[model samples]
Target: MAESNKNGATARLRNYFLAGVLITAPISITFWLTWRVITFIDDRITPIIPPQWNPESYLPFGVPGLGLIVALVALTLIGFLAAGYLGRVTMRIGERIVARVPVIRSVYSWTKQVFETVLSQSSAAFREVVLIEYPRPGCWAVGFITGTTVGEVQRLTAATVYNVFVPATPNPTTGFLLFVPKEDVHHLDLTVEEGIKLVISGGIVVPDQANFEGAEVDAAAKAQVAAQSDRAENVEGNGRKRRRRKQTQEPRSPGFITRLRNYFFAGILVTAPIAITVWLAWEFVAFVDGTVTPYIPAPWNPETYLPFSIPGLGVVIVVLGLIMIGFLTAGFVGRSLVSASERLLARMPVIRSLYSAVKQIFETVLKEQSRAFREVILFEYPRKNCWALGFITGPAEGGIQELTPDDTVNVFLPTTPNPTSGFLLFLPRRETQILSMTVEEGIKMVVSGGIVTPPDREVGDAAEPEESTPAPLAKSG
Candidate 1:
């Protein structure tokens, strides 16, 4: 009897502990998320807020929630204004302008839908929570019934469909809007609020649902990694037992170690590019300051007047000096002087070759009309049917065109990971394929080894031909 009493006490203690945890966790998470949101808004909105309008400007110490409060008021005010006649007309005009832009139109429409679904409290918006397969078969997700399909969509898909919005976990703002068939949808017993809560909690904190029995739906859904075994499971038809090949247990949340690793990688992703860019910029400025600062005229230098040294003074001086040189070089006297200098340099053997090469490189690069490495083309290389990316430097004139054919064209086939060095091929014009990708995009693909790709464009809808006025590489002596 004493042993039984002790066991009962132990069980009660465990229940009490669990109940305390159940109460504490949600409250703690809610407060943490709230703080995070407030700070994030403050960081962004604080800078843009005028000193006169911002209350923190008057205070000695910075206030945190000022920006958040401002943001709330601004959004509410905007909403109120949007409902007015003038604001509505302005919005419609703005939308019309946005709709004219092909890419922006798609993005705007999608963004508008997300806002409407999440914020709208109308009868047609998120009427009820539902269950549907998403991403792939057997992978079920909790969704909200945004609306029923209409017009083109209903006509195109020969079935009764509902516009189901499956909100991503941890963030209900952005997610997939699936046009799910009505037959596939399982009307969950949970409310819309419960569904949203389920998503925000990352499938944790599941509400007790009486739609489906335990151990049966898990086997049928063929559950995946996500902790979706319980909440995302669909109801069985007519309470029939499903014949199952596999009976897997509910997937658990990621362990502490996994979460730690993910956080570490995420931190690296955010910091790496910023840290590298800052370091590189600093190094470049320091190099210029060390090499060129001493030579700069005292009057021209800003550091001479300032009490504290400026970081990018050398860079500013260099840019101004280049602009001045360019202006001087455009004059008739400058041209005569340059011609005389070139004639003198042409008398040398090695010096002439180097100077000629450098000058030609600069001229070609600087000239807007010179389409050197401007056009992206494709041609067979090494073997037939095997293609390669090449830039059209110019026409295959001189001996190469004479020896081959009148239709021959010069192509520079760039290598992967390094576009500095490449093979030069002279092929027939008919054999080459002109691609829609620009030279910049081609270089990017080459540098990244095909990791980054340019979006596909229709062949017939390609831009104008690569050649710009007076054919390329036909330079006058």
Candidate 2:
């Protein structure tokens, strides 16, 4: 009895341990990630910031986190300006000036275009998530649809166009972008978050509830069989010849060893979900810590809070704080910061070049939050038959079209697996079919390389048709 009690206690303790591990890992990992990103930004600022003006000089604390604060304030002020009319005028003036400068103008406008596409609310880019086939046959991935094909190519050759982004497995941020025709790309039923989880797990995670239900049904059926056998045995012992005859007619009862094996296996099937969940969660925590924690300074040791840190708390707090400041700058505190940054950057010649380059990229990509990567679509490119993912930006407007004497639309085509690079093609509108899919779906398909096929009407095709009710002809008469 004592041995049995001890074993029970050990089992309970193990369960408790597993539960704790499952809960705390995600929180600690998030904090570690936030800290690492902050530190990286500080490292970049450290080399450029003079020792006297540096926030570190004034603080006794190890590596000040105020640079992140500065970035937040700056962003907020920029948001405020961008939201208002005066800000637009200033931005236009800056654009006009940049356009006049030869080398700087080319780099500035290109960088600006990318940012505008991504940040502007009108850009409508990366709005929808999708699935696509990727890497090899039978493999699928999640992606987003950015936009459509554009430019003189459209006048020359009318085609239905799309831009698909196929995200990398385990890392959705990096992936391929294929511009294909609208007809070839199919939409998936899975949500972006679910798709990401599937990719990261490499298809190991199954979400079908039917499997569990079926297992339950099988177990219940086996239980019913055992119950029937018990009743038959009882009847035989209770009565005489008739009962003995009835028992003989029934099938043979299962052996004790076989019954025991079935029961044990059933128990395992029931607990397998909980066991696997605990194991995966533990592994996830370990992986995040291994990847992000080492980059953090020793002083912020996350292990101290082990088993509980508030999941994604770091990301939540930091992002919220930044956004809040942005909201405030849209009011007042934000404006002052932007003016200061602009003035400071404008004063130095060499610093101006570097600052402008980085600032331009940030403004276009992160500042205005343009609609560059709004819709993901499939666009046929290079030839009549092939297709790839392309983002639909605005219609092309340039002197090149005036020179061509033919109507043309412009489109930017991004490279796949690494969206940062790709071809820029001009194609006609008639050839392109605007997809029913949202921008997010197109990206997943592109990034996944066509692996993640989104569910369609066919998934429900197995269900039997229901009988229709007879028409009320008698009432009409």
Candidate 3:
């Protein structure tokens, strides 16, 4: 009896300890990460201040978050300078000088454009969340409406089309671009941030009930689906068909082994995402630190004087260095030097070709006005029956369009799971089937290998015949 009582107390203690760990671990890690970031920023930025001007120099102890405040102020000052007419003139002259260089021109131009687009508040990069049907009908995906098709693409298509960017799950930076008709896409009520979260979580973090219900396709699409379903039912006698009832498994008390397995799986599901996120962040910081820390002068380096290594000092240095470079490059003297350096690189045979190609691609995509990944599309590929998810890059112009008699569109067919690499198909516009799913949904489907499907709607409800009232005829008589 005493042994049994002792065992029960031990079990209770174990459960309490587990519960405490679950509660405290996340909070502890979060605080630790925040402290590390603050410390890193302080280490790099604090040294820049002269001893007389520094708060730490007079204070009994060092203050946290002072470096972050300093960094913000520095960025604001830079922005204020860039906004002026003199700054604008200086920037243009620098750009012209950089453009004169062959190899460096490519890298600098691309980097500058990317930074500008990202930093620009006016840029509509990923605002409108949309839905698109991907792979085939009955399957849908979420995506973002990037913009409308422009240049050669607009001229070729009879219908007004939109550009959709379908980003892949876990890492949404990569995905397909599809050109879909404006009428076909189902717009979602979810915001851009919410959509990103959904993509990263692999559909586990869905929106609220109200938001989910509000995500409806166009009324015309509903009618069309209903009509199609009606036709299908008519062709294959509805009377002969019966709905298959799904069997529900009976609930039973779990055995010890079963309970243990369930608990283990639950623990994994809870911890894995947090662990992976932290690991990725840590590795990124480490990488930046590794690359930049070695370059720091021994006298200026924090690690040289300190007993322990600082975590994000290199990251802070790298950011400040980039900003300083940008500031310098905006001036006349900096541009001339950069241009001279680039001209020397251009003399290299193999490097020039690679540089030019890369530069062109960056300029095309990163330009604020350029609509590159504009639309999500469906095209029959490999064979007639086999359908694939693709992004409409643009109209097939140049030598390729001249070869084909029909009006052709350039479609990038991204492979399942891994969307980074895919086949580029030049298909006739008439042969392509435009879908209604958004790029976000499309990416989720691709990442999950068709496991994560969009919400189902009843298609044939409107098509069903209603019973006529016989009383109305009698009343008229």
Better of 2 and 3 by TM-score: 3
- Model 1 stretches astray by more than 4 angstroms: 1-249, 283-287, 304-308, 459-477
Which regions of candidate 2 deviate over 4 angstroms? 1-14, 42-64, 79-107, 133-140, 152-159, 188-197, 203-386, 389-477
For model 2, residues 315-377, the per-residue Cα lDDT tens digits are 444566689888978976679898898899899999989988988656655545564555444
Clashes of each: 0, 107, 28
lDDT of 1 by residue, 1-477 (tens): 999999999999999999999999989989999999999989978999988988778888999798877765565555456556886697778767867976445434433433333343333446567676664556667876655544323333436656555566797755544456554556666767887889999978688856322212343443321224232333222122242222224436778765555444433333333344456567899999888899988897777898998888788878988998879889998888889999999999999999999999788866999877778876655344223468888788888888997598878876544567667889898887776677765665444333233445653323321110110110000
Model 3, which residues run further than 4 Å from truth?
1-18, 32-52, 56-62, 108-122, 217-477
Error of 1 at 114 (Å): 28
Pairs with backbone N, CA or C atoms under 3 Å apart (clashes), candidate 1: none
Ranking by TM-score: 3, 1, 2
lDDT for 433 in candidate 3 is 61
Tens-digit lDDT string for candidate 3 (361-409): 7876678876455556656544333334677767889999999879998
Please give the distance, in angstroms, between residue 38's alpha carbon in candidate 3 and its true position after superposition.
Answer: 4.2
Best by lDDT: 3
lDDT of 2 at 349: 92
lDDT of candidate model 2 versus the reference:
0.52
Q: In the order shown, what is each candidate's alpha-carbon RMSD?
A: 19.4, 25.4, 20.5
